[model samples]
Target: MKLFNSLLLVLIIVLNFMFAEPSLADPPKITKSPDYVEVTKSLDILQGQLAATKSGQARSETLSAEDLQKKIDELSFQKYALEKGINWGQCRNETDKTIAVYGPKPKKPKTPYDNTLYFLGAGQATPTNWDCQGIYLPNDTKLTSLNTDPNQQLEGAIAIKIFKGTQLIAKNDPETGALELNISPSKFFKSGEINWYIPNVSERNIAFRVPDVPLGGEEETD
Candidate 1:
């Protein structure tokens, strides 16, 4: 009877240890699925193909633009899936609509600006609010004319003048033929223009207008 009781106590202790929760040091190992490996290999191949196509060295006899575009679209979808943490098996079968609903969105393309003066927001000159607005002059370009609206008075002075609603905020006179102004857009107010007098033999001038809100458009204010 004593022997039986000792064996029973031992069995209870073993059972308790077995049923206890695991310690932090004994965490389950994470293993990648076969599908994940296969998908990753496929993605690498697709990337290589894209590179070859771009470098004009595609193996195919004739790769049309349409075909190249289709490949790009497919790659984009797969990339979206991978970013969203979708399993490889599920991603492979996902429809465009399903992917759109669950996967990450593609980023918008960046706008390309050239040696021209234009408004900054919405990629159009639609008289946006002038909280912080200014012109972007490329390197080696010259400023032409500076003026304020409600009074088309040109700042004839051969100096840089920044204003906020007719009140001069800042001024400078670099006097260099090539100038680039990257000042904070907040210094100048709406309906203001800057003229750069290119110090060449021609003395040519270029004009840029500050963006303004509607009902206070450039023409109305000028």
Candidate 2:
């Protein structure tokens, strides 16, 4: 009985410390950096579906063979883009609703200080202080919005400064650790699941299909 109680007490203490808020002095790394792993797995499944379609073993109610191939091509490109990595940048809410994001901690789930909770307003963009290389938002990822007035800003809210052209970043292979080519990820975050960008991407090669627009802190870029 004494041994059981002692172990229970120790377990509780460890749990508390693990969930404790982190300090800036020892900023956390992105333990689950949005590497689009799940999305990739989904793509693999889609590939099987495609193969099944060709084999006449399966068929979609709405999509044709051409449609499936196009989708595969598009998703494959998004995978390629993220695997290359992105720059530490900002996230622009192209959404009409406000969104509160935690880190890719979404460490890069990203984390949020009690007040560090960033609420991205509709149609507005917020710059990140993240050092992540990629970000992804799953389909089931629910988003929220907060109502606030510009005149009634938060106490320690920092001034909004738009960044310049996207920085060129290299994408590396996870298994080989070999450096591939580089790219500038897009900074737009809008509706749809399967998202992965922002905090570290520019040039909008995303699973969520949004147009590529200049982030406007540096010279205009594609």
Candidate 3:
């Protein structure tokens, strides 16, 4: 009787093992698209290059020609990728929103004097006297001047005179020899010429010019 009970138990265990289901394997991982992968790799390379350039610049050294060219090429590639709707590791939904808000945002159109301010000239002027000189400048122009004369010291007040038909419309006194003047479109509507005057014995070496128009749009005015 004992031998029969043991055989019955063994038979039940064998049946259970034979009838059990096999465990399923995990699903395969989905990878990023080829373009996406390429963009990520390019971004990594660009970051490294930029870091190297920054480090070199911090030490007052310039990057080699080859390195510079490589950076340029990488930037070009990134531009191209962005134009083709490639996002830098961002999800598709987020990228779409960004594109909608910012539009294409392609490279800015190259203007004749983009971000450039031409150096008109430098000369000396007498103090307490106003020279009504004629000059042309665009609307919302900025003028910067520095005293280049080593012999003359900045001791008194200096003013920039804006004239329209021999009438003084506006004046700005910088006080110091180094001066900056921001000319608005409303103030300089009729004339582009301005006078440099100092109200003392000191002479001023003045330089003046206009900055290029901004690329996108007019800057916000205070």
The order by descending lDDT is 2, 1, 3
lDDT of 2 by residue, 131-179 (tens): 2222233332221211122123122211121112222222323444232
Count of clashing residue pairs in every prediction: 9, 25, 1
Q: What TM-score does candidate 1 reach? A: 0.22
lDDT of 1 by residue, 1-222 (tens): 999999999999999789877663443221143333444555576667767877888755555545655655654554454445432111111111110001111122222321112222222222232221223222222332332222232223222222211111212224432322333222221222323221222112222223222323333221
Clashes counted in candidate 2 amount to 25
Q: Which residue ranges in model 1 land beyond 4 Å of their true spot?
A: 1-31, 62-66, 86-222
Tell me the whole-model lDDT of each prediction, alpha carbons only: 0.33, 0.41, 0.32
Model 1 residue 163 distance off true place after TM-score fit, in angstroms: 60
Error of 3 at 217 (Å): 47
The alpha-carbon lDDT assigned to residue 76 of candidate 3 equals 57
- Error (Å) of candidate 1 at residue 186 is 53
TM accuracy, model 2? 0.36
Tens-place lDDT per residue, model 3, 36-80, is 454456557656666666677432145554665575575455445
Scanning candidate 3 in windows of ten residues, the lowest lDDT window is 93-102
- RMSD over all Cα atoms, model 1: 22.4
| Model 1: pairs clashing at backbone N, Cα or C within 3 Å | 143-195, 143-196, 143-197, 144-195, 144-196, 144-206, 145-194, 145-195, 146-195
